[model samples]
Target: MWIWFHKLGSPPHFYRTAGRLVPWFGIPALLLLVAGTVGGLAIAPPDYQQGDGFRIIYVHVPSAYISMFGYVAMAVAAAVGLIWRMKVAFAFAAACAPVGAAFTFLALATGSIWGKPMWGVWWDWDGRMTSVLVLFFLYVGVMALRSAFDDASKGDRAAALLAIVGVVNIPIIKFSVDWWNTLHQPATIAKLSAPSITMDMLVWLLAMVVGYTLFFAAVVTMRLRGEVLLRERGARWIRELNAHA
Candidate 1:
């Protein structure tokens, strides 16, 4: 494990490995997303309560799921970089921020749209929703702090620290709907008992989740590739990469 971790920290090794995995992630991501969309929007039946408006779940739930997943991925990468002093982990943490933020943004947007019809309001001070908003802001903050530093290494370290600190909020966000009397619904898909949803709805939701996971992998690969180029600007690998480009 240590050997693999160290190897991943090496720029060339990561570049080569990511190049290989991109296609693996990319192909499945595209296929799953198409399947999820078609199944969710067309095949899944409308909610008995919310009617057709509930169909937004295809977009909303998947985006919300990915938003949290991305944050956790970024924070975990940052933790690895800080504890193990892995430069590639830092590169991955940096690479993951924008992608995570984009998912969070999608979640918020879809949530708001879902809310207007279901809850009769576009915005609310509910606990879970509010914390998720904070999570989004946290992503933005980390990205801004990264650019603010004149020293790149310092920036990486600082962002890593912030991410580690901010991770405490993830559980808070996850549990908020339960702990507080928030208007937002509690966990439906992650429950211990059989899902509260129909098989059709469940399948579509799972498909979307898989698709979003793939989309994240695809975007992160592209971003990581860019980060490698910037960090390895004067290295021989850069010349080789550029030649290939």
Candidate 2:
């Protein structure tokens, strides 16, 4: 295990691994997104309560889930990099910021669109919504910090520290709906009870979640590869890698 960790710290190894994962994740992501979106929008019956307005849940819920998941993943990677001094871990953390930010944006946008139909409002300072908005800002802060330093190593460390600090927000966001009475609905799909939703709705939602997961993996791998190259520009292996590219 230690050997594997050390090996992953190598820029060349990490880059090659990311390259391999791209196609593996990308193809499934594309297929799943297509299936989920089509099934949710056209095949699945509309909600008995919300009617056609519920269709937005297909994108909104998945994006929101992944946005939180992405941040936790990034924070973990940052922690590993900080403690273990693993450059690849830092690269993973760096790759995550932009993708996580995009998902956060998607969640916010889809939530607002969904909200107008259901709640008759476009924005709210509700607990879950507010925390997620803060998450978007956290992503921006990490990205900005990365570019703030003249030295890349300094920037990486600073950003890693910020990521570690920001991790406290994840659990807060997770329980926000439950911790406070908000306009947002409480846990349905992830609750103790065997999901409140029907199998038809469940299947489409699950598919959408899987699709988003794959998309995140694909995008992270692509971004990590670029980070690897940038951080290892002077390395001979990068020259060889670029030659093949």
* Candidates' RMSD to native: 1.3, 1.1
Model 1 gets an lDDT of: 0.88
TM-score of each: 0.96, 0.97
- Whole-model Cα lDDT per candidate? 0.88, 0.92
Instruction: Give me the candidate number with maximum lDDT.
Output: 2
- What does candidate 2 score on TM? 0.97
Q: Where is the poorest 10-residue window by lDDT in model 2?
A: 5-14
Q: Spell out the clash pairs found in candidate 1.
A: none
Candidate 1, superposed: residue stretches over 4 Å from native: 243-245
Give me the overall lDDT of model 2: 0.92
Query: What does candidate 1 score on TM?
Result: 0.96
